[model samples]
Target: MKTIAGILFIVLGILTAYQSKQAQPAAIDYAKERVQILQLIDTESKAFWDKDYEKWASCWAQEPYIRTMGWWKAGGVTVVKGWEERGPRTKQHMEQHPKPNPQNVRRENINIRILQDAAWVTFDQYGKDNGEPVMDMPGLSRETRFLEKHKGKWKIVYVGWLLEGEGN
Candidate 1:
């Protein structure tokens, strides 16, 4: 009876180890999702500075219900309800503002947290604007963005910017 009990214990131990090994793939999948989200953020930044409106738009969800909100150092909160609302405004804004030359944009101190199909991201962005650090301008800004997965792709769902010390 004692020998039989000992064999049962060993079998249980092996089963436990196998279960733990099965758990690892979830972690690996989460890490891969995090990396993909980070890459999407990088792509968004690149598209913005590159003046590629199409690419910039691609970073956002194409759904009719998908909305975007942005707060700037100078401008207060601006909300775009849907693509119809965002499209013309974005186009006009891009047309008005000149694309950064030499693409001196920087993304720093990025943190991403994944929660199931959603992710929250925060980052510091700084770069040279006319030979001066953009951070030195009116406001040093830290940005937070919310992303959601749709059709196996992560898209920016919301954007919030917090500004400190004003400049221009």
Candidate 2:
């Protein structure tokens, strides 16, 4: 009787452990998530360059804490905080500069790290126009983007970049 009871206790312990493990969340599909993130980033850039304000706004979070900042040799530093401020300013800029400034930019040395609902991405970007390097804009820039997954979609929360050289 003692032997049977000891074996049953061990079996019960194993079953309990197995049940607990099964209840844990499944692993994240990082490859799929990375693709989704890259798509969103590309969409945002396209919308901006196309001067499509509505599409551009869709890529960003409408939260108050959202921000966009950049630093360049000519412009020094610029920080735009809050979606309310950023959104309106962007719309106005697009309206003022309605011409589509199409970009043939190459992004390289990209790195992305995802942590549950948040992600951080960094890349070096080179701009080109008419089969030649862009002269009026920064030729290369180091860019960083912060995104958050909300309601099963990723949205940009922060963007910061540093241009490699002065603007023309």
TM-score of each prediction: 0.66, 0.79
- Put down candidate 1 lDDT per residue, 1-168, tens digits, no spaces: 999999999999999999999876444377788789888987887776666789889998766666666565555666778777766676666677655434544567888888766899998766443432331223355778889888878998776766553442
Q: Candidate 1, after superposition: displacement of residue 154 in Å?
A: 1.0
Which lDDT tens digits does candidate 2 get at residues 1-168? 999999999999999999999888777799999999999999998888788999999999999999988887666788999999999988987787777878867899999999778999999888654322222234788899999988989999999988884341
In terms of lDDT, the poorest run of 10 residues in model 1 is: 129-138
Best by the TM-score measure: 2
As a whole number from 0 to 100, the lDDT of residue 48 in candidate 1 is 68
Clashing pairs in 1: 138-166, 138-167, 138-168
Candidate 1 wrongly placed segments (more than 4 Å): 1-28, 98-103, 131-139, 165-168
lDDT for 152 in candidate 1 is 74
Please state the error at residue 50 of candidate 2 in Å.
0.3
The positional error of residue 73 in candidate 1, measured at the CA in angstroms, is 3.7
lDDT of candidates 1 onward, in order: 0.71, 0.84
